[model samples]
Target: MVNGEFYRRYLNLPDPYGQQETSFTMLFEFREFEGKMYLKYQREEDTYNLFNKTTNAIILKQSFMKELFVNNVLPHQTHAPDATMNMNRSVEGQAKPYNEAFWKYYNAPVETARDSQILKALSEMESKP
Candidate 1:
């Protein structure tokens, strides 16, 4: 099981020295391509800080997990361009539009739990070393 403290440390909360806890929930979608992988995600904003725990920053969480999978878990030979760049280009392209719509439609609780499972699997892989 992943310790909650681990997540707190990983996020580097609002206060560096303060004991801040977070309660944000994140949903992730994963698909493996021929030689690369990508993550689809959504998360609550930093609303937890107002309380005691902090809500997860969706972009930060996504970037962190992406790096973890690439550097720690998935096997790859070299750095690849951000896959979303092609989709993000074009001042008036539909790719960006579609990307947002995809996440809007794809976000769900089932996928969220599945994403957590995948992270656990990756963590287990690290345990071997």
Candidate 2:
């Protein structure tokens, strides 16, 4: 679970929509690609909501979310070269309209099943020294 103070800071972040906030609980998926671990954010119902509420609120583009994940969520972790390349390719090749890509990535079938997996992963991660 995210710290309450962090959540408060996230809620109060500046954005194009002003004091916008996310009522939905965010989910994450941890996967290994090309021998490197990657974490992908997911949200139920509204895919675009994730981008708007998180990325936009931080006044950064969607690509910057990777930095947030690496630095904050998985500090000291290093991604494989191919994993980074794949992520960059996917981002660059997103659908014409942003929403389409949002839905494709965040609203995809795998995302719907990620909540439980994320919880388990979080528990395991926290149990480590």
Best by lDDT: 2
Candidate 1 worst ten-residue window by lDDT:
62-71
Clashing pairs in 2: none
Candidate 2 at residue 98, lDDT? 50
lDDT of 2 at 14: 50
Distance (Å) between predicted and true CA of 126, model 1? 70
> Quick one: how many clashes does candidate 2 have?
0
Clashes of 1: 1
lDDT of 2 by residue, 1-129 (tens): 166532322334354343423333446767675677677444332111223553444343221222113323444557644443344544436335556655767745555467888988999999999
lDDT of 2: 0.45
- Candidate 2 lands at a TM-score of 0.21
Give lDDT tens digits, candidate 1, residues 33-98: 666666534333332222223343233222122111222333564887567645354324423344
Determine which window of 10 residues in candidate 2 has minimal summed lDDT. 60-69
